[model samples]
Structures are given as structure tokens and as C-alpha cells.
Target: MLFTSIKPMLVASGDEAFDDDDYLFEPKWDGGRILLHKQGERIEAYTRDGQLVTAKFPELKEVAKSIKAYAVILDCEGIVLRGGRPVFDDFAYRGRISLSAKIKQAVLTHPAVFVAFDILLAEKECWNEPLSERKKRLSAIVDTSSSLMATMSVEGKGTILASLMKERNMEGIVAKRKNSKYIQDTVSPDWLKIKHDKTIDVMILGYREEPFSLIIGLNFRTVKNKPVGLVSDGFSQADKDLILSLSKELHTVKEVKTQWIRPELCCRIDYRDRTDTHQLRMTVFRGLLRDKRSEECVWES
Candidate 1:
């Protein structure tokens, strides 16, 4: 039997972190979510969006060989790390390289590590089992010492872990109910993600008139600065007035109908993470950063 894809359980976002004895907290890896299927000598990997990405990550084929089960479905994150920290840029770069020869070369140059967090199926369906039991079965099946490693979780320490992740510049920590059973394609409160606040100073590049949004761009030292996304929320009326005034002074006719401004003006933005296409996700304009410069609005890895 061959399995093409398995809908993975989703996590709900939380505003803050709290301690709970019935929950387990793990580091939220900043990478692509993937499901791996192995049966006999056949191996396949799919992204969260149900795209077949097996050809892109040829190195993960080694992961299938490590499993002793006749058939298994593993839930994991395809993460590329730099100096022990998960780097989304590296994962994005690898995902974009489509040529077979380049993908093979990229596997050697920038290999991705699979962080297995759950076992949806092994020998038989295990989604009905409690999370704790599923984790034990996952541990027994996966070789943690290889590129594929089991994700470690801490009980009753979500608050502390969230603080540490913030201090370490990590994305966030996910809290999972210990006794909750996996629910495919569902967004349940059983899994909650508490992301640390990430604020970046970006240049105000343009604006949309209809929705009244500000287009923001980040200056890269080597790469050309481009508009990442638009922010229309998290601003007061006074702030909007100030932006309007500033736009009038800096606006240029680079594009028709759109108000393009010089990149000298910068503002602070808060966001959860970047989308697969490198656009900002859940972004909101905090306020204008009067003290910052456009050249200083570089993205931090």
C-alpha cells in the first residue's frame, strides 16, 4: 500500500505562555512542515500544502532506511540550521532550488534535518493514541542520532521555555496537551503555539489607497530591498495622520496611482513569521521609528 499524504494536526496561536502540568512544551522550529511515508523500499515526503517534495529532499530517503517498520508515517519539520539555530532562509533557499543536479548539490552543501514530533501511523494507525504514547512509539522507531531526530518536550515549563526562546531569538514554543489524540487537518486547542514578539524596523516604501495600508521593505546589504508586505492594523488615528503627512513630503510618481516614498522613513513592524514565499505573515504596523534610518533596516537572520 502507498500513502501520498497525511493531513497533520495544526496548532492554535496563543498570546502568552503559562504553566500547565497536563501539557508538554517543545521548541517551534522555523521551517517547513512535512510528512514522511515509508513502505518497503519506497519513500515519499509531502509538504503541509499536500505538495510532493520528495524529489527536492533526496537526503531524507536515508531516514526511511532507519525505520524498521513495514510502513510508517512520520510528522516532522524540515529545518536547516546555522550554528545550532533554525534558519528559515536556508530552508526557503533549498525549497526554491528545483533542478535535479542543483538539488543534489544543495543536499551536500545545505542539508536539512528532520525533527520528528509525532507518529501518525506505524505498523497501524496511531493517531487515536494519546500524545504521550505516540511519542514513545515514535522514539522507538526513529534513530535520533541521525539527521532525523526526535523533538524533546518539557512538562509544566511552557512559561519558562517561552521566555528562554525569546531571549535566544527563537521563533517560539508549542504547548501540547499530554493526553490529546492527534486530529488530522484540525485546528484544536490541544496544541497551542506561544510565539515571542519579533519586531523589525522596515522602510516605508509605498501605500495602498483603498485599504489604507503601508507597504514595508527591508534593506539587505547584498540583496536588493523589496516590498515584503503591507500593514494596515495596529496603528492609532494619530499615527495614521503622521504617516499621511510624511507620505506627502516623500511621495514620488514611480508607479501610477500608488504613492511611492523614499526609503528614508522607517517604522517598526511586529510579525509572527515569514510565509513560504518570503512575505511577512500576521504583520502589523506598530509605529514609526523616528530614530531609525532606512539603511539600518536590514533583516536579522
Candidate 2:
């Protein structure tokens, strides 16, 4: 069956992990989402956004041999693992190469692995089937190997799995309802992402008025204040007003688009992780810190 015209199911965010007898929890691999289609020997891969990435990740060409079925479509995440954990920056770098020689060399140096989580088709339509049955079928057909592996899952213990994956610095865990049918091209509530809670304290550097965002930086005693990233989320109207009042009192003439502040105010930030350039990813302003001093918000490592 051709899955090129279809999109992978999307997930909604969950606040915290919990135990649920009706849901299955699986590790959320830190990598690009891909859907693979196998028709006899011909194998094709597409991104969640419908971008054809088969030519980019040449190592995935062997996926057909790892599957027992002659025709099947699988939903997976393509990741490059190091030390048994996914290094997302390395996987992202592999996606950006254009030259054929570099691509071949990267395949040898840093190969991609597809972790199958769900099966859409196996000689018949399986999208309408319950997730639990589809998972069973996926495990039966997909061989676990270095290049292609079926995703491992734990039933009714999302909290435990989430904690373990967090300790390993893995992305997070996804909680899928066991009886939920696969819904294509939609962010279904049947699936939820329970991410690890990570936070940091940073000094507020400035603010931009148009989009209403804060320019945050990490204070350092030995070095100059480092521009970590911008934070525009998780702010209430009251929080915005407080920042506006503070900016007026601490405003400086050294402004360049952003209204520069005294850099004395400190606040706690929630983030997913750091990007390749060391900037915070998916930052959210938790709240202002009254007890902590700006100087104390120094870089940890």
C-alpha cells in the first residue's frame, strides 16, 4: 500500500506523566519522524511533513530486507544513536548534507536507524485497527536490528518509563491509548507527549514590544553575559505587565530593536533542550524569581 498520500499522526503535549491502564508508553526518540513504504524490493521513505527523504538517508534502503512482509507501510522515527542515547544534533546534521560523497561518508561514519512504532498496512489495511493490535503486527513483521528496529513500549507505566528515559537524556515518552485508532494528518488526543521537566534560571536582558518576547541571557562572573535565547511563551498578562513596568524603570539607551533592561532581574525558564548553537530550545518563562540575584544566575557548565 502507498502511504505517500498520507501523513503520520501527530501528538499533543501533556503536562506530566501518569499511570493509565488504557495507554501504552514508548520512548520519544530525538529524531526526525518518517514513514516507510515497502513494495517487494523497492523501499520509499517520507517525512511526517510529506517530504521524500529516501535519497538523503541511504542506510534506510536496507529496511525492506529486515521486514518479513512483502508489502507494508510503517511509521517510524529516524535517529542516530550514540552511547545508547540519541544525539539529536548529529542526526540533524546528517539531514543537511547535499553532496553525494559526503552523504555516503556520513552513512559509514554515522548511520541512521529507523525505529518502527506502528504499522499502517500489512497485506491489508491496518489503519482502522486498534493501536495495540497494530503494534503486535508491527513487532511480528519488523526485525530488530542496528538499522531497523521495532520500538519498545511499556504498558500502563508511563511514569516509570518517562523517568528512566529522562535520566538517560532521551527526548521523552509518548502515551498512546491502546484502543485508539490511527488518525492520519491530525493532532489526535489519543496520543500525548509527556516530556521531562527541565528548567534553568536566567537574567532578563531586554524585551521586544511588537511580538512581546523577552531577550534572556546567562550571567557569568569570568566572562561577559551570554545571549542564550529569546523566550515568548508561558507568560501571563500579569507577567507581561510586570516586565513592562520593570523595563520602563531599568530602560537603557543602548537599545537595538529590543528595549534594553538593566539585566538585574532574574527569572526561571522551562526548556526542552539546547540547540546545536547552545541556545535554549522551546523555552517557556515559568515566573520571575524574587529571591535569586541576577549575578547568581550564572552559567552552570
Candidate 3:
């Protein structure tokens, strides 16, 4: 319930309405959107759009067991860290590597780090004081230098922090306002993300609402099967409004009688891998594909 995706805008320097100095800028890791919850070793992972993900990441269960808390909810991005750098595609490859000694060897060789950005619940209590305050509690819990998941935090200079957050081979950065809180509605400029350069075309599977997230189900021309993955980030208010307007003309969120227009709009997403089922793994929406079509895309040669 803590993870949400809206559009991103570059924070301008010296804007009176914005506090550039107070904001925390961190590199956005291109990885699977995950929610970590703990209730006395009863831990599990959930996708950004609220799909259960515990079985997919069995290794994490042990670590999740170590942390003893009544209930702690964290907003984090989970990905395999290879050579101190995160390989965003590992989530897709998990199925292939299941139960393989070599798989754990490789993943441990290049482990996955959990970059937690917010502390929604702490000490069996709601840490809803303020985003700035909640982060302090979250930071105190994870030590990036020694945690199994490569947990990290920025200190001394955030500019330096921003630099460390970068993995030249991975995704981009996500900048957030320290003073912000979890707001259910849009127009909150407290967080923004910048991502990598790989883009792909996809179709709208539908939407999932907690904070009104976009769930992009993947499909390409000439291949007919279940989608590969779901995209949960890189959308803004205008973008959501636009989607709502367009989708309403065809379908309603509550109604299945909707008609989704094909090819009128296309989206370019960034991903690190593909599911055997043909879905985008660890992806985000770059924006609408203004000059492309859904049918024009060919992934299966």
C-alpha cells in the first residue's frame, strides 16, 4: 500500500515554491517494484500494483525472518545486485534459476539490494509523522554497508549520495522531497524519477488503484500469450487524467464493457529483461509512443 507511481519533473534550481536544499535525491534503481512487510517472520513481497510476490523471492524470506517487528511496511525496489551494481532483470530470470546452487552463487556473487525510500509502518506502529521524519526511522534500521540486501543510505553530501546511487549499467535516479508525506491524491511534487535509456512498446492491460497506478501488461505483434510483466511507474497527473479521459471513452474502471482503442496511443518503457511468458521485467513507462503503433512492434522475429 505504500508504493505509488506518478509522473516525474526535473526540480528547477532556486524555485521559491520548492526547497531544493531540503530534498533528497537518490538514483532510481531499475528493478522490480516491491513491498516488504514483516509480522514476526511472516514476511512477504507485493508488487507495486498489489500482486503477491513472496514465492518469487524465496531467498529474501530468511532475511525477512531476521527482522523482528510486529508489522513494518517499507517502500522499496528489489533487484539482483551483480558486482555491487544491480541487474534489474534478475527478477525475470528468477524462474530459470530456481533451486540452482549456481543461481544463488551468482546472485550472492552479485547480490540484490533493497533500497528502501519510505517507512510506512515501524515498530508495529504507523510512522505517518512526516516523510522527512519517517525516513529517519527507516535509515536507522538498515545499514547499507553490511546488510545482505545491500541496504544503503546517503550521508555527508547528498550530491555525493546522488553519485553513489548511480549504476552506470543500470537504471536512473529518483528524487524526492524530504518534507513530503503520503498523499492519496495526485499533484504531489514530493517525488520524481529519472530512468535508463532502453524503451519498448506495450499495451495497457488495465489499471490498479491504491494510488491509481498504471499496470502495463506487455504484448508484441505476432505473439499471442500472457504478458511478460507489468509497469508501475513513470506517469503524472496529466498523464493519468489523459488516460482516464481516453479510457472512459472506451471503458470504465468498474465496467468490462469498455472498448480499449488499439494503436491510438503507444508507450515506450524501459526494462532489463523479458519473461518467458513475454512480459517486460522491471519496467517503467517512458511516455506515450507518439509516432508508433501497437501492431508495428515485433519482438519475436
lDDT to native, each model? 0.85, 0.86, 0.55
Best by lDDT: 2
Q: Write the per-residue lDDT of candidate 2 for residues 1-301, one digit (tens) a residue.
A: 4846577789998878999999999999988788999888888888887887778888766777899998899999888887888767567778888789999999988789999999999988899999999999998999877799998999999989998998987778999999999889899999998778578899898899778899898864456568889998898999999889877888885665788888888999988867655588789999999778877887643
| Candidate 2 deviant stretches above 4 angstroms | 1-3, 199-214, 217-228, 231-253, 261-269, 273-301
lDDT of 1 by residue, 1-301 (tens): 2476667889998878999999999999998898988888888888887889888988777887777688889999988888778888888778889999999898877888899999988989999999999989998998864578888889988999998888888899999999999998999899998887688889898887766888899866566567888888898879888888888888776665578887878999899877655578788888898988888888767
Cα RMSD, model 3: 11.8
Task: Please give me the total number of clashing residue pairs in predicted model 1.
Answer: 0
Error of 3 at 285 (Å): 21
User: What order do candidates take by TM-score, descending?
Assistant: 1, 2, 3
**Which is better, 2 or 3, measured by lDDT?**
2
If ranked by lDDT, best first, what sequence of candidates would result?
Answer: 2, 1, 3
* Per-model TM against the reference: 0.85, 0.76, 0.51
lDDT by residue for model 3 (1-301), tens: 3223322122222211112566666655656656677776677767665676566565665556444445677767776655656665564455345455756575565455566666667774444466668777776654453323323434224445444444355444555666676653344556655444456676564555455654554444444323455566777878877776766554434534333343345577887545445556667677776576555554531
Clash totals, every prediction = 0, 0, 14
